[model samples]
Target chain A: MSTQWIAVIGTCAFAFILKFVGHSLPEKWLAHPRIGRINALIPIVLLTALVTINSVTVKTKIVIDHRMAGLGVAIIALYFKLPFPVIVLGAAVGSAIAYHFSH
Target chain B: MSVKRDSFSLSFAVGAYGTAFGAASATAHFSILQTCLLSLLTFSGASQFAVIGVVGAGGSALSAIATASLLGTRNALYGIRMAPILKVKGFKRIVAAQLTIDESTAIATAQDNEKDQITGFWHTGFGVFIFWNIFTLLGALGAQAIGNPSAWGLDAAVPAAFIALVWPRLVDKKTRLIAVGAIALSLVLVPFTPAGLPIITTSLLAIVVGWRA
Candidate 1:
């Protein structure tokens, strides 16, 4: 295998190892109030960051485009308690339409 | 119960998102086998994208690994939170750990009872795994047959799905405050930092908020 494949495999191993090691840690340690609370909140933080970065960044630069419109519509859909697929399709089709009009 | 329904829907939605990753890796010039392997073995969505993003930019495999590993670190954290509830042993532990990604951990924790949590964990973990891999092949073939995924706006699909996941969880003032903080911190850092770095840096805010909360 090439270096890229090696890296991919190694990274894959490292991920599983992290999961294994985490499971091995003493439950009492993670049970600490602060650690537990933060761990619970970590998903929110990570997902927020992921959504923001994905929506805004293109290459090395910050380019706001129809993706933002799609995100906006999706956020609105979320507030309205629209079912999941509608949210996904709304963003996809919404942005496609915005891109169609914009360009 | 509602939890199982949510788990099934969430897994299916996330599984369908493999189409985005397949198209993305294909667009980055990964061979069909490599794309499928990334989904199967690496299996984490953000890290897979990070690998493709880094490698696509002509970075070395080592650099790609480093970037992807940074994103994958959160799964370890998820594992930490889940280990108690999951409580697997030997080979079962390995299976549990492999399934211990963002979606599984989130859905499992959302449950009010331990039995339901375990059910949610397996349903989501395995469900996403099975569906995600199958759709990945479909996406790879589709990408090769068709043209640019971005032309069809498939690039936005993953984020769209992710937003739906995070939306329902923002249930209170404190959670909302921290999310707003994380997003603002991430956006401010976007211009100054590299592609994936801003996301990691936003964790600093999570830390501060978690500390103060």
Candidate 2:
């Protein structure tokens, strides 16, 4: 199999194992406040990083482009507390317009 | 009855959003089959997105797996929350583990009574599974038919979706600060680090802040 396939399958297996381990292990293992605190921040940090990496960077270089405009529109939508789909659609529209003008 | 109704409505809404996932995965250059497999096998939104995002950005398989698994850590915590409430064993336990995700756990725990809790858990679990898979297929087919996903600015949708996912979670002052800090750290590291390393490195910030707090 190709490496992509391996990564895909490996990720799925890892996801399942993490969940299963939680079910099987003693609750006390993860019951610590410290663990909870760290866990709470993890997704926040990782996802914020994801938003940054996906939006502003292409490969190893950081370049200003339409994607930044898209992110800006998304932030506005969030500020207004719009629905999820609407926020995404607005960002896409904003970016598409910028992209059309740029090229 | 109320639990089932609530679960069904919530499930449909959540599942329909899988269309974005399907389209995003396709934009990330996943095959339709691969996209479906991600929905079927992985079945978690953020982690599945992280996989496609990393791999599509030219990260290695190891990096993809690490990022996806790290994002999935909360599901394990969800499983812990659901264990006593689920109280199953053997094959059933495995099945329960599979369904123990954010939506199901939240719905289950939200109910006032144990019966409603169990009912909410199973109904929402199965309902989301069915609808999410179906919508994922639909979205993949739609994205494929549209020719170039990027032309439609679907590339922008990926980060937009991440913003939407994380936005709600940034409920307080400290969380918002950490999120801003993470964004800054990632921006600084992007030029220097490999494709996926910047995101992974930001976890240290979380660890430090979380430990201190």
Candidate 3:
């Protein structure tokens, strides 16, 4: 009804359509070797991008900050082959300490 | 200890960010109803954030939709990745489509076997959906109280979870090289591009690697 509502509905619909279309693609198309190979790599690159963006940036500006400390701890935890929850906790605690001291 | 634990851990890591989103949407002047609708229907965290970020900055509704939709592109890509693996039809297809998201797809594909893959997909999808919605409500209601999510280092949780997800996949040198290149590509494009584009652009590196390989 309102502009905000309209935007919300429109965006939601568009997102759903995008998702549905991908799912609805022909099995033959998806079965192509190139498509399959490319799909396998999608998560790796995207997740890498996600990690970089979340750690280094505050909004649009790139700044080295406490999040990087969290990332460092996460890497070490991963290297040690810690459990998922522990690694997550280590990163959060690492960042929180750095954040408190910096601010 | 496999898909179940992985799904649960990944779900919580991803869902916890909903607090940040809830606080942000409320700060952007979205009514609780509007905020909840975005989480319920839109369901995608980054895209939802894009909507609030644009609108909160006094941008037009059209701009907000455009930006949010751009981020939602990744879900479509994930849907493509999951379709054959899921093999759902008719009504089930829609359900699967709705549940198709980053955490679900990531955990699903990360598993070794078909059973674990399916289990991971459904568990992570539903787990994240439940936790994300609940956290969104709490964040919206207590927007003022939450202050900065990053202060709790919740910001670190996302990337940490991402690292954990992708870490296992980088077993071979080729995949590892591609990951490194993507990280470099994304960082380079961050300042020059809009929020979501840099991430999307990294897919090019994957395509190139996949093509060459």
- Top model number, lDDT: 2
Off by over 4 Å in 3: A1-11, A59-61, A81-85, B1-39, B44-93, B100-128, B135-144, B194-196
Question: What DockQ class does candidate 2 belong to?
Answer: medium
Comparing 1 with 2 on TM-score, the higher-scoring candidate is 2
| Model 3 C-alpha lDDT per residue in residues B1-213, reported as the tens digit of each score | 677998998888778767657765776678888888998889987677666655553445776687567667768778887898999999989989988998899889888898889999999999999999998898788765656756877667667766876798788888898899988997887677666566667777778877777
Q: Which candidate is the best by DockQ?
A: 2
Per-residue lDDT, model 3, residue B117, is 92
Q: Across residues A44-99, which tens digit of lDDT does each residue of candidate 1 receive?
A: 77677667777777755677888887788788888899976677677877777788
Q: Which stretches of candidate 1 lie over 4 Å from their true place?
A: A1-11, B1-14, B24-31, B45-88, B101-124
TM-score of the A chain in model 3: 0.72
Q: In angstroms, give how far residue B161 of model 2 lies from its true place.
A: 0.6
DockQ category of candidate 1: medium
lDDT of 1 by residue, B37-139 (tens): 8888888987787676555534457756765676677787778888889888999998998898989998999889999999999999999999899888887
Locate the minimum summed-lDDT window of 10 residues in model 3 chain A. Answer: A26-35
What's the true lDDT of residue B82 in model 2? 83
- Report DockQ per prediction, comma-separated: 0.50, 0.77, 0.46
**Chain B TM-score list for all models:** 0.73, 0.97, 0.70
